[model samples]
Target: MTTPNELRLLPWSGSGDKPCYLSTDDPDGYMSRLADSIEAIQLGTASELLEEASEALDSQGTSLDDMRCLVKELTGALRDVYRVAASRGHLLTTSDPREPTY
Candidate 1:
């Protein structure tokens, strides 16, 4: 069990996924190495999805339903990429002040 003061780094998630924690006391332990592997795999996947999304935009048929679905999946993948960056303490890109968020 993790102490209240300890950080529980949940680099992945869902109702089925379990929380992963590292002992701050041992920075290079087995669990720490495993977490590092998992984070790398996840970030690699994000890169692949980004590539796919770019391809999807460039070579797609003119079907409204398909376009909508592509946009939806791409949006989700981009969100995951941003989340991973944030968890790693990376700064998010600032949005244009004049642009509408919606």
Candidate 2:
């Protein structure tokens, strides 16, 4: 029997880009470790992409194509990070709207 809290978190999402989780009784198994490894790689790549983007911003000679590629990579990394977080029941929270005073 597997419990929700003991389930393994997958590295990616399911249909419609929804988070997918594994209900494995063995959270310390190979697949779970693999997922963790992949997530680590994704985060690491995202960090590297951010550094490159920053460097690109400082360079006046960066080409449009190179910038576009960097944006695409960063976008993918963000999506992956989001999916992982969402899988772990983590969500983005926005502050409640405050009524404007006339």
Candidate 3:
């Protein structure tokens, strides 16, 4: 049985907006590689959205409706970025050599 710390949080969610996890010993496996690709894409999207948000904020001609739409997209991107960060953080903590394994 795979432990929680050993499970990798997938880049996407399952039904009902629940988190999905991958349990695999092979980091180079198909699923793991797919997840890595997705995470990279998500992070890239978030970075682009952040730049767009900054531009919008600095522009005096930006309309309320445009800002609202940008906010919605930003919210989704932020969620994905946060999930990636959390998954990476968990992996780090579990695999860290400095931590004494029980």
**Local distance difference test, per candidate?**
0.61, 0.75, 0.94
Give a tens-digit lDDT track for model 1, residues 1-102.
335445436466656765544445564767667766777877787777677667767875547777787678767666656556664552112335567777
TM-scores of all candidate predictions against the true structure = 0.55, 0.72, 0.91
Worst 10 residues of 2 by lDDT: 90-99
Q: Once model 3 is optimally superposed onto the true structure by TM-score, how far is the C-alpha of residue 76 displaced, in angstroms? A: 0.2
- TM-score-best of 2 and 3: 3
Model 3, C-alpha of 52: deviation from truth (Å): 0.5
Clashing residue pairs, candidate 3? none
Model 3 lDDT vs. the true structure?
A: 0.94
Give stretches of model 1 more than 4 Å off. Answer: 1-8, 14-20, 62-83, 90-102
lDDT of 2 by residue, 8-88 (tens): 557876899766677765657887788878888988988899899999999999999999988999999998887677655
Most TM-score-accurate candidate:
3
The clash count of every prediction, one per candidate, is 0, 0, 0
Q: What is the lDDT of residue 73 in candidate 3?
A: 100
Better of 2 and 3 by lDDT: 3
